[model samples]
Target chain A: MAEAAESPGDPVTASSRPLFAGLSDISISQDIPVEGEITIPMRSRIREFDSSTLNESVQNTVMRDLKAVGKKFMHVLYPRKSNTLLRDWDLWGPLILCVTLALMLQRGSVDSEKDGGPQFAEVFVIVWFGAVTITLNSKLLGGNISFFQSLCVLGYCILPLTVAMLVCRLVLLAEPGPINFMVRLFVVIVMFAWSIVASTAFLADSQPPNRKALAVYPVFLFYFVISWMILTFTP
Target chain B: MAAVDDLQFEEFGDVAASLAANPDATMVSIEDPGETPKHQPGPPRGSGREEDDELLGNDDSDKTELLAGQKKSSPFWTFEYYQTFFDVDTYQVFDRIKGSLLPIPGKNFVRLYVRSNPDLYGPFWICATLVFAIAISGNLSNFLIHLGQKTYHYVPEFRKVSIAATVIYAYAWLVPLALWGFLMWRNSKVMNIVSYSFLEIVCVYGYSLFIYIPTAILWIIPQKAVRWILVMIALGVSGSVLAMTFWPAVREDNRRVALATIVTIVLLHMLLSVGCLAYFFDAPEMDHLPTTTVAPNQTAKSS
Candidate 1:
């Protein structure tokens, strides 16, 4: 019976039998020998810097990389499990989001002390610090993802929050009243929760099951503090 | 060699097919069946090897499950099919009133208590009683004014006063109901704060009117200065109660939202008090009273 189960042309019976039911549907059966050396194709590797590669024009290389970064940004916004886009770490999205958020925060308070506005350096430092802190926590908790990849995910996750901040800035344009307060409150709350969920989805893989909840708490607190700041931002 | 290759391929296919049939089967374990045990024979350590293997081996299934779970849990505000807005014991109303009158932290007890035991019964009755009291007092003051003038004012219009009082009182409740609706809509979006239900809003607004009852009673006091002093005192008391009750819920995270809520509550309270004072207490000037003789023999005298 076992020998019949192993027969090449008897796949239907083999698949129907419990003994051969452990296989993934995607894997195809083909007769192949295991004695000889088997070669597995490697995924495309990121090119390393070399003198030969340096011969390529800087502008052309930068343009090509930028295109790749744009694709990665789109992937982050509408994530696809099939794509390994997070592997292509890029700083452009993070940088843009950080600056935009800071500007949105500062726009409402333009009339205050001219220097009181959120300085770009200050905003960048805060964003960097938060990302690094979360990355370090994740790493210490058994996250095996690369530091840059985690940072990229963390940064991209701020997109919803950035949109929230923009909404708050617009809300400030309305007369400060109960209705206005309600709108601002609603935006911040939703964005804050979104940020936490999005970050956890990308970064919580390395955490043990027992520690996952504990690890997610800091991410929740981080987004909450940001949300609070955005909600309270009055021009 | 080719025949051996074909045989090996068939074995591989059999394993794959078996895996497809029973995805949870232990046959997928990467531990080599023929190899001797290594290390402590415990769960895999975080040396990155196991994770990499898992990622490479089961990327599709893992991601599909994760995405499915995420999509399933993403809807934050599910429709509440049945909601009980009012549910509080009669005795708790006194507790709520006492709590509302306490200091900032003490007021949080009222908020927490109200949150747990929300009800409109106490607040509704309290507001209704105050409105009725105000209407009755306004009629009493009009009767006194007529006696002082030695001419009975055209049988004091109880209907007009009652209608006005009812409209104003209804507004006192309506505004809060509207505010509750707005808060509910807002809560649906962000869902950070535990939202107070419609009944809770009414209860808070009702308890806040505890001070207004005294102001309504004092309306019959003929002295304008004394009435104004009493009105101010009433405002102070009710405003403090509102601040105490609402502060804890609003203060911690969003200062702007807190400010807006406080302003709305205070404004609504003041509008009710002012409307009561203006409509019920501010009797029409004697000069505007069209002098007419009820009796042909009686002479109309100017005061």
Candidate 2:
């Protein structure tokens, strides 16, 4: 009787079949040994699956490659995936409202004049502050964070920023010459680069330094440039 | 040839596909300590090569939840994740500039110098000399001519010339903006630092001009408040200049950072404008002041 179709006595191999063959449907049993997690899902559901119908070897290769890519990109921006106060909305909302209010007050000052108003130093401060305030709001919105939490994040991130500014000021003071401008430029550049990397690091460590979040001088520069160009050139 | 065919790595295959993609890679025995994790090998039961290969290679196409069967998580910013959110070329130019600025030996020298002194002077001196030379060469003649003119309060001839020059200077500034933008696009990623740096310098230098300009000219309201307001505006602009020019680490674009900047600038401008109005125009003084305030009842109320 055709040798009983080669049926074996092995308990787990009653009707032995290759794990994968010409079958149209595939069920993947993924068990991460290191993590001790077992996940069984359809092969077609996997975003990284090679194709609608792929062989075992091909599937293995795709998963490995995907893991590597995800790890690299993920680490590039936030190494630790930690939370911070900068994600708080309560703190930012009022802070933003205050800034807006301040600007409105200034606008009133301008309206007092028919030909235009006098220049005020505090106006520029408000401008710089605007950049920081807006950025905080944007992060909170994107991060789905509480307004108050974002304020805390800002508090932490601003530390490195303050230091960089102080250092730049000190450098400029020592020179007070034409070269001072160059030094100032250099300081700003260095501070920006440092902040980007530092923030990324801070994001990784759950206990990010509140003092560091204040290092936003670089973002100011970006706004200053873009806005200045638009204001000056758009006409 | 047979080996390549036998190792027929389906384009969208597993980790093995990664290995297959790199034909030059020497395949070590799977038993090698480094080749495989130290954990016990999985049961050699199923023909999983194809299944695993498909999983690994099809990552991009796989819209499946990173958490199996779970909903995908959204990131902090939706716009930031958009494919074209960043202009890549602009960043590349920025990178190129950074690369040129940081040569190995030169970088080492600067680092060591800074480390020893913690404040750079040698480079500052060199840069100063160049700036001084340029400034003097470009403006000395104008300086002398201005000094020669006895009617300094408001020379009609000079004012006309200056108005024309102001227009030209404004035009000249555009060149830097465009060139910088182009450069940024070339190395869009690097644009992060270069663009910010350029903007900072402009803020600083632009405000510095006020130091030389007559404060009285800014008097649009009453005299007392107008001057004070002007001074404040100048200072605020100067601060922005200083912050932008001096701080390099401020290049990132987080949501909070962007918002802070916008609010700060708008408020600053508003404050300055208000002060100017309060100081420059003496509408209330019309009835009180014998010389000005043509309108009636204005001065009595202001006093």
Candidate 3:
């Protein structure tokens, strides 16, 4: 067990003694390697975010992670010219957006048969599958961005469309009409363009200049498809 | 006898000099004949292109040397084991996708690109993208048809997603399985035919479907003529890729079997596109019809 090794505190002291000069120094750790170590629990995290150390040592505090994820959502919403979006990219925001957007797009359960929208899983798959393909396309085009970083940008940029979906859901709550439909259309189209702009801005610097169009086209299609879902979803 | 000894010493010195110069390629050539892939990008240096194989053999090392290295061992069930299949670089994937998009006739895609490194990453995402492309386009076409009709309520035919997923994944995975099995059988029957690993065949099928992603999007055009043309172009590009890649694999078989194999590959490709066209996007041509959902002429015709 690492308990004994933890008590030693300083391995250098143990090795400095002349008696053990011929013997190898003693050190023991990594009994259980954990991803939690690399998470670094961003600067803005709460003071006791290390509460994860008190319980299961393998994970950071659930609250700290949620806070970090929330900050990322803020980055996506604001689209400030800051690297915070790229610096601490994570899939949690994307996953939440995809699920909520999928749920919002789903028709009421009152009548599944006649109610036409994509299946719950269909929206889920389309969002993720779209993000991944866009990422892969950029990667294939020799974009220098790391795979997950591209994914994080593409996924996070869905925040606008996610907001658009939420707005669409609220608007669909009203009775269907030409004026109402026009409102939803305007909202969805603007968000669709915003999604593309946000993603391309984050992705543009990394891509080779000549292939930027090839990379951005898929991002366009990806958001257009999701916005299509948002626009087409009827109450 | 003296001249013979001098000649032997000279050859050994030459070998030592080559080893000293470029140890990596010379080492590869020294042991494994199978290691020297014909398409290996760079020619081995320190030896002539023609004699690199024959001379670098190090056949003179008659003394037994103990080989002391692990055989790339990993446990079969771990993620590490399957990780090898997905190991690939970005440029390689880009080249393969380009090849699939515009298949050059007489070029065997498998031997040139895939056999060196058959990756599961491109294939997996390609199938996924195709699934969404078909499903979303199906929904979009349906929505376009009845955009502003009073009586028409847009219910997305949810089944399209499942159906597209089933048809596409089955084609990408199952057909490759069947084709790989058949190729294996043919390889045994006709010894000289080139054969590919199942992963490589799956890779070929997966990448070959990349054309359909754009074609499926183009299916949103409410005109049947445009849709068919798109499918035809996609099938034409992708089918030739499959056939050309597989022909070299099965060519040594009897003419009947070889021709049958190519015909089946192209026909199956045709069937998939046509079937998708008919099932998913088959709707009233909104382009010909007026903006409203009412088609009184069609209704009268039906009645």
Q: lDDT per prediction?
A: 0.57, 0.32, 0.70
Fraction of the reference Cα-Cα interface contacts (below 8 Å) that each candidate reproduces: 0.00, 0.00, 0.28
Superposition TM-score, candidate 3 onto the true structure: 0.63
Give the per-residue Cα lDDT of candidate 2 at B270: 45
Q: What is the TM-score of chain B alone in each candidate?
A: 0.59, 0.22, 0.72
Candidate 3 per-residue C-alpha lDDT over A17-102 given as tens digits, one digit per residue, 9 for 90 to 100: 66344122333233222223333465326545544366654445676788898888877777768888888889998888888888
Query: Which model is ahead, 1 or 2, in terms of lDDT?
Result: 1
| Rank order (by DockQ, best first) | 3, 2, 1
Best by DockQ, which number? 3
Question: Which 10 consecutive positions of candidate 1 chain B have the poorest summed lDDT?
Answer: B33-42
Q: Tell me model 1's lDDT, rounded to 2 decimals.
A: 0.57
Candidate 2 — which residues are off by over 4 angstroms? Answer: A1-142, A199-235, B1-303
Error of 3 at A145 (Å): 11
Which residue pairs overlap in candidate 3's backbone? A116-B155, A116-B156, A117-B156
Over B1-303, each residue of candidate 1 has an lDDT whose tens digit, in order, gives 323323433444445444543443323222222122212111233422342233333222322222122122224354211112222323345556665554344434333445333544456445545755676666555545554353433233334434654765687578777877766665565543334555556677777776666677778765567677878888877777766665644555366886888888788777767767777776543442546523311221111
Cα error, residue B79 of model 2, in Å, equals: 17
RMSD of each: 27.1, 24.8, 11.2
Question: What docking tier does model 3 reach?
Answer: incorrect
Against the true structure, whose lDDT is highest?
3
Q: Supply DockQ values for each candidate.
A: 0.01, 0.01, 0.20
